[model samples]
Target chain A: MVEIQNTPPHADAEFHHHHAHATTSRHEHGHHLLQVSHLSVGFRMYDIDAPFLSAEQRTVNVIDDLSISVHEGEIVAVVGASGSGKTLLADCIMGLFEPNAEVRGEIWFDGEPMDAMDLAAARGHGISLVPQGVSHLNPLMRVGRQVDGFGYSRAEQTERTARRDKLFSRYGLAPEVAQLYPHELSGGMARRVLLCTALMDDPKLIIADEPTPGLDLDLAVAALDDFRSFADEGGGVLLITHDIELALRVADRVAVFKDGTVVEETAVANFASPDLLEHPFSRALWHALPEHGFSANDQDHPIPIQSTAFEQGGSSDGGDATC
Target chain B: MLEALSITFGYAKGDKPLYEDYSLEVAPGERVALVAPSGRGKTTLCRLLAGYERPWSGEVLCDGSPLPSSGTCPVQLIGQHPELAVDPRLRMEKTLAEAGDVSDELLAALGIRQEWMRRYPHELSGGELQRFCIARAVTCRPHYLIADEVSTMLDALTQAQIWHFLLNWQAESGAGLVLVSHSPALVERVATRKVLIG
Candidate 1:
């Protein structure tokens, strides 16, 4: 058995402290960094071979009515099983949807409605994405130059180099690693490099889609720590992960996703008790946790909570609150 | 029984060996969990057990004899990444046919739909492709099975379903299982014995 050392008590205290301060301060502004309202995504698939001669087309709804928001100085974690539209949500926010994808929703950034053009313009400057697969990296390019994308001017090159070096060292990557190609790096190193690319530009919003899967526990924690620090500095983070334990550690709020929608959006404090959660799926997830003895009884039946619960703002606290 | 006796292996000559005089044994009707962090040679060990790779100095024995050098070994390995293991050009039917005649019961148990058989590997999701791979591997009815993070790409429900089927099959067939995983909770729950490797 792998013995994972307890995170130092002081780290928890520090996180709680920062969380409280950020929550209070951000609420005063009444301005959310990112707001996604009633978002839905569907794909148009065409069947080329048809006996009747006319081609058949069907729309598969991947995400439905998924609404969530991220406030400055807070990390809102989207937690769900795979194929639950978590990655779709991240891709929608990052404007990385495919050509056949049909998106219907209002995605507002910095109090302004954003379209595909606006999102394209804002990408890499106002918003950045740390994609799920490390294969997203350019295999032909050196790791360093890939991280430092398009630094044309001498002054920009100098600044980018300094930032790249600092981030590499922060992630425990060696200076020599910058010279290697994408295939040369180990799984963990490639993951860290993807992180470095997203952090290279100080984007206001960072959408990390399942960023911690291949990484070891320590490196995963370290990556979350960086996200926590980034949020503490008044940036917004939408952390998408299947590892609920890691999410609970760093996220100020948790959005429980089921099917294709947010069933419950609760404070991390609510995770202390199953009864505190408003939705049955959220409670089922809690019961399914490893500490809960890995109960498989509820695996077959994921009891959907009342639609009234979702319609009433989906907050566990029974208040129509947006964090 | 499957045994690795005094195995010494390294990727390159004159390099620090990944496994130095390592030894492990799994008897029939045993479920052994190999617990380790990523990039710690868990895959290497699984490969060695499956006879996909050979050890530099020691031998892998099945029932007190050296593994057959050719043709349908009794030890089967299911790797972590399904995309890397499967053939891109082959349809799911052909891929499953490569192993032998697969049962409809096994396909249902693994939640592999009939429609998937008509599709190629790229047409399916990672989880779907993984289920097909598992089906292909288990159809061989090997005496020993090594699963290297086989269900890591799957969701929670799929993971549970696949594990349940695998455990049931192992119980009935009296096959030795080597489950290599990073999830301690999963290992603790499913494994009869645990072995830690660096």
Candidate 2:
């Protein structure tokens, strides 16, 4: 169950000032963005001790003791088979994990520990996470208000507002969408809006979990570009997803998770070669790329990233076959 | 038969229609892939076919019978986002059961054993949830199953497995399959025929 709560502060003045200072050092190279060490999370099962009834619960370890670092301006993708607990790992990073579940991890941002950080503190200090879907945004708020609602520091308001418009232009979303609720916007537009919201905060690190799941190839690429641009602007990104093809395209380095553990971590450039994905299962995953897109050409061929306005010889009209 | 006659649609009170004068037909046992670039109303069309949303103009006829304009229709729509398909609180068994009957035999065939029934949606992996969603849709025995980008989030191996499972189920159940995908590469592999929508 999701234990969503509104709790008061666990830290005050000095901590806030510390995080505030860290937030200002956005372009400082000496500041390490995120350092996660010895992270472990497990769930409790009541049925574990019970011998009666059909109900059997076991202490399931969703994310085992793990540690990985994501530096500023780099895109690190977590890739794994389905059921590998990739999303669970992401939930921990975003501080949304269930309270009952035990999470033992040290998350440090610019040398400051985040173990005691609350959601408000995290949000206020420039950590923005884009959850899995367009629905992740508030459905009731107009898209524009939501983008403007990143709750930036009083000093950064003007800069954030200016950044907001830049993001809209980069993503090719119509200016009119600022007034529409998330439900009213098209699927792609909603995704762009969420991206804009994340960008508006100007966070040093952005963790996006499967941000472009069902979008078409062109739109998916555009969405990836949106994140890449964020990273290019000196923000680190921890992207958790299951699409290896996508990881290869957008990730600088990729981590492979299996059964709640990161079994392998390497650069995307090494993913295609035989030595890169060494595990039998990962090799099998690589071999399984459906033949159509890459059969005539090698998988290494640069994927064509079409801008939103470009004509791909496909229909712009809503009908007459363009799937 | 799954037929839409001149369907026109957009958001409520919206003047700019996303799609206007759109029509399509899928015969029984036909595996038709609706291909379109993003933002071309693929999901809107899927919602129309599944009767989750109403069309501003025109009609969606399933098996030559008119579908309800608004409200839950008999059609089952499996969206591209697996994360949204299953409720967080419900156990896998309860979730699958809500979709419809799940025979012990069907569960095993889909590789979801009895043990998996006790786990919550959050406990399952992306691939596991994807398979579960497919199983749930098939269990409903819908006349027409609309799978929108069902494999988009999956890795290559997992996606291949999903395609195989869907193909085998379609063969056995003989339900009309309306698959909407952005990958032309994927369509060529699974679809018997393709409908391109822009």
Candidate 3:
């Protein structure tokens, strides 16, 4: 039998939102590996509430004026609450725009205007993205073929096969894993397979979105270490995740994303102490860590972030990132 | 009380048993954290407790009896991937209704907005989908709740919010909670007891 303690858990917790926004000015310096300026994405949707004959359409701004950069040989983590149009940012960079979407922004890759150089040609060639869900792996295809991409000629198939094997070995996957399907692999194996896919083409910049979700602590840390190794070898990484502690573990710099925009970008060194950080949002995140009382609100003031530990946040979940 | 009586199970016939004669017990108001690394059958154990899978031997009992084969089960399980729990074709309202009648107060506490009722699972974020899953699980009025890394994908603030709500719900309902988490800090903060599994 268990002891029954019916005391209301954290009854004193009542949240109220009143936070000051902080802004910083950034100038484009020389040339970085990847730089996005004033990037915004809005989807055009039919107004269901509007009269049918009129058929009014409205632009739902998912991301607005989002500016972030990833330099060669450095890992830049874009930390944000989940569901705030974070993945759309990744989609924009990859040129995977939704139908009826209006886009406005400046994206430069290797100092060249991304538009002038077809981003499609650049994607999977110079830039690779480890999508959030391992389910991105085609369920119908074999693991090796998916990692190797499509091959029409015999020689091309052979070359890609060699490359896939090399990547698999590097990631500690067995030779037989190539024959398996997505469902056949365990969670850790599936994640490693995702990493192998990202590394197949020797891409310079890798964008990993929420790659560590189902992984255990050791595997999660090892995944970050893999990114660290990639950076040490002159590659750049844009790791998008909601876990601040995990991001702080390996990222050299951090870009704090809120409401489809990056509110703060600071060095990881500043995270040792919350006082060194500039934005109030960043401080709120510091207070929300599992090790830090798992509470929300900074000094009884709430600004979109609410935790049951004190008051209610506008949303819930470390889930802010799960979005 | 919830009991796993000397359970033995495996995925395939030829393979060595994943769980052999493993037994455990949990009582109402007890928040038990099951600690183990990934691929260690933590998820399998949760599935067994919730009757998503059947054990090859032994049994899972609730209050000295087997779990109800139909109707609302006494054990409610919320897995890590909310995207998997929801049906892509169904609207949120329909899915929530499947669990029975969910009160507005419960929906409000979960931060589930009215506008979301008409939206399909794919239209909502993973967090929002998870909130729906939580609401659905609670609607069953379970005697025990098993959460398997439910908040692993969320941020710290969102994670805190989820655990806080879960703890409060447990207190109010006097239901047992079984949790699996990678974050030790979270486990320390929420669990009333720790049960290690390998």
Candidate 4:
């Protein structure tokens, strides 16, 4: 069910490049590239009596009072504990949600108002998603085909092939990897391919969810640097991760996510010290860094970024985790 | 001691061996870090030690005996992706049940909530799902544990919590550990001695 399918392009997946100015920027969050304001998402319980046949009963709010913005050429990181409903926000942006879900938000992207349909329609044109796990890659398809993505004419396919090869080579992945299945590829190679797929689209906004797990130090940093390059090219990124330290390295601003909502959104420079931070949990997260002694004094709220290095190795390449 | 004796390994389709004459040893209660840059065969070696994969020429022996082919293996492996190791259709509690008699203390230490048990693996985040895997493995009381990048995707706070519990568990159980980690800070704290694998 998780297999990659030949992706059919949305009816308007082409380069629209319109500002489509918002009649009412309700939150006054600036005319940023991506603005999410007062977003409230909840899941309704299925009717216990009717079960499969009935709709919602009670709404359990998952994300409430969430407001965040990403300006052009800026990477806004939404850092939170894993499973703290961060992906729900990305899902809201991407217009993916369960049938029993209740979502309420005013999202403006590229100066246009967005509901679920607008967000769904904007995918891969105005925005692209670098999804979390390698399983997002289609197992049956060749690495190159998936990276090129679906919905292209033969001529466009050929062009995508060329760009895919170029992107592959850029990541130090062998060009031959295009012909290989996902199972045949190593974990690191799979991650790079995922990143390459997001990069190939050249969308105005890229939302990457938990993208650094399988990478090595240099490669993880390299991936972050790639996002920087994307932002430098006048794009925007909503980088969602549990790694605050990694996020601090590249993000211009940080939005600390708590139980289903953002508790604080501040500049990365505020991480200079805990005193500069506004939230108690955010301060605890600062102290939780490995350099800060890896303390999880707040037992209920425990999460961290990566700093461990493989202290020894011979000459190395970045293609795979398994030889 | 757990020993990988003169192992020569290569994927069946590959033209060359990934590891040739590679030997390593871990005595009981020793926490060994397998450190290397990416694509250096660190994970492959983990597979060999845990009896998940067989070496072409050499053998993995534990306590002067070959690892058992069936039954509960003494070498329990906690792989990188917890989703891969769990069944999608089953609830979390059912999957944990497959591991047999998991203690309440183990559950509490990992910060696993009772509510989480009813959900499927896909419903939980990677960090939360991984806690179940660690609980299942540790409950077996294996003589050795192989942790391959166990906490890479987790937050620093959760990463610290998991490792703290692991180190304490290892000390109490005196189970040897063979781990692959990307964090030097973690390696500095967890590994007693590190083996470099290329």
- Specify the highest-lDDT model's number: 3
lDDT of 1 by residue, A198-304 (tens): 88988888988777775555667876787788778888889987678777878888888876788777678778888777787677777766555454334335321
**In candidate 3, what fraction of native interface contacts survive?**
0.50
lDDT of 3 by residue, A1-323 (tens): 11122222111111111111111111123345687888887767666567878967776666789888766677888886677666667778888776776889889886778872478788988899987655789898888888888855989889888988998888889999999998898877787788889898889889988888777767788878878888778788899887788887778778888777887777777677778777877877787787876775544444223322101112211123344
Cα-based lDDT at residue A1, candidate 3: 10
lDDT tens digits by residue: candidate 1, B1-198: 899999999999988999999999999999999877777888899999999899999999988988899877899999877877889899889999989999998887776667568776655556667788888898888899999888665544446656767888999999999998667777877899999997
What digit string (tens of lDDT, one per residue) describes model 2 on residues A142-227? 77767877556876766665667788887897778787887887776777787778877668778787787666666777778878
Cα-lDDT of candidate 2: 0.67
The DockQ of each candidate is 0.25, 0.23, 0.44, 0.30
Model 3 lDDT, residue B163, Cα: 77
Off by over 4 Å in 1: A1-25, A47-52, A166-177, A184-189, A297-323
**lDDT (Cα, tens digit) per residue for candidate 3, span B57-149:** 999999899988888899999998898898889988999999989999898777777777877766666667788999999999999999999
Q: Higher-lDDT candidate among 1 and 3?
A: 3
Model 1: what TM-score for its first chain?
0.78
> What are the clash counts of all predictions, listed in order?
0, 11, 17, 14
Candidate 2, DockQ score (0 to 1): 0.23
Candidates sorted on DockQ, descending = 3, 4, 1, 2
Off by over 4 Å in 4: A1-30, A47-56, A132-202, A299-323
